[model samples]
Target: MDVRPAAEADHASILAIVAPILAAGETYAIDRDLDETAVHEYWFGPTHEVFVAVSDGAILGTYYLMANQRGGGAHVANCGYMTSSSALGKGVARAMCLDSLDRARQRGYRAMQFNHVVSTNTRAVKLWQSLGFEIVGTLPKAFNHPVHGYVDSYVMFRAL
Candidate 1:
């Protein structure tokens, strides 16, 4: 798979990859009913940098990286990732994440943080851990999972 910076032209395919994940409301904290305009602004807004992973000209996954906070806390990077359901378990997400981390370090970020990783998304949680991110804290009843009801969230971080 090839991972590269995203262009406006990739928006449609990115949406196609992200839509099902958002609709599931199981992993990310975003509104399941989130609209395209909002997603566009959030993903491609001025402060964020987005990337896409492709295989044979098909967008299999995408990720967005941005400052974790403003001012003093801005040295850290924050990211969100999504892989097309059809592309799951194929290492597309992992490749995208590795590329994002490299980009984050190149952008001068000192650390990378994931503010709200759903605890029940075991695959993702484990993957993050394997990638060297530590689960620093747990926010009890933080995510209202669609099927699992209230679930915990993990604050994961890793030094660049």
Candidate 2:
């Protein structure tokens, strides 16, 4: 898959990838009730740089990179990833993550952090660990999973 900066034409595909995941309420700690306009704003806003993973003219996934915090914390990067449901288990997420790491390094970020990874998402946790991130902290009962009730959330980090 080829990973590159997202363009206006990729918005629809990006929406398709993120919509199902956001609606499921199984992993990300976001409001499932968000409307299309708000979702677009949250993903495409100026706060971050968005990218898409494509192959055979199809967008398989998308991710956004931004500073983890403002001012003193700007050296650390943060990112959110979403893959097309049809592309799961196909390494799309892994490719985007690797690209994000390279992009982070190119942008002079000193570290990358995931603020709230739901503990129940083992696939993602394992993939992230394999890619060099570590669970630096865990919040007790931080994520209210739709089917699993409350679950722990992790703060994962790694140097770029």
Candidate 3:
């Protein structure tokens, strides 16, 4: 798979990958009913650098990396990732994450953090842990999962 910086024309493919995840309200904290414009802005906004994982000319996954905070906390990076449903279990996410980690380091980030990982999303929690992230904190009942109702969320971190 080829993972590279996203171009303006990649917006549609990014939206296609995100919309279902948003509608499910199972992982991300975004509002399910967000319009295309808002969703586009949220994913491709200036604050984050977005990338797409492509294979056979298809966008299989995407991720965004940015400073976890401004000024004093700028050394830490934050990221959000999504894989096309059809591409799950095919290592798409794993590849994107590895790429992001390298990209973060190259960009001078000293650490990476995931501020709100829904605890119920076991696959992601496990993936992050395997990649060296530690569950530093947990927010009880922080996320209102559509199917599971209120669920705990985790704050995961790792030094680059």
Candidate 4:
């Protein structure tokens, strides 16, 4: 598989992967009924940088990275990752994550932080831990998981 910076031509596939993930309301805080235009603005917008993993000309996963905050906080980066349902367990997310970290360091970020990671998403939590990210804080009932009622959200971080 090849991992490269995303272009406008990849937006459709990016949306295809992101739509269901957001609509499922099980992970990200995105609106359940988010429109295509808004999704485009959020995922492929000018403010952030996005990358995709492709194999055999099909995009299997994607990730976006951007400054977590402005001014003094900009040195720390934030990221979001998504993989096609059919692509799970194939190391797509892991590859994308490693790429993000390398990119963050190359861009001069001192650290990376995930502000809200749903506790029930054990796979992601474990993956982050394995990659050296620590659970810095847990906010009680920070995420209202659709199937699991209220669940704690973790703030995960790792220094570059």
lDDT of 2 by residue, 57-152 (tens): 999999999999999999999999998988999999999999999999999999999999999999999999999999999999999999999999
Q: Which pairs of residues have clashing backbones in candidate 4?
A: none
Better of 1 and 3 by lDDT: 3
What C-alpha RMSD separates each model from the true structure? 1.1, 0.7, 0.6, 0.8
For model 2, the run of ten residues with the poorest summed lDDT: 16-25
38 Cα displacement, candidate 1 (Å) = 2.5
Candidate 1 lowest-lDDT run of ten: 36-45
Candidate 1 Cα outliers beyond 4 Å, as residue runs = none
Model 1, residue 75: distance off in Å is 0.8
Please report, as a residue range, the 10-residue window in candidate 3 with the lowest summed lDDT: 37-46
Tens digits of per-residue lDDT for model 3 on 1-160? 9999999899899999988888888999989998889888888888989999999999999999999999999999999999999999999999999999999999999999999999999999999999999999999999999989999999999999
Instruction: Report the C-alpha displacement of residue 156, candidate 1, in angstroms.
Output: 0.2
**Where is model 4 more than 4 Å wrong at Cα?**
none
lDDT of all predictions: 0.90, 0.94, 0.95, 0.94
Clashing pairs in 3: none
Q: Against the true structure, whose lDDT is highest?
A: 3
Residue 136 error for model 3, in Å?
0.2
Clashes of 2: 0
Return the lDDT, model 4, position 79: 96
Candidate 3 deviant stretches above 4 angstroms: none
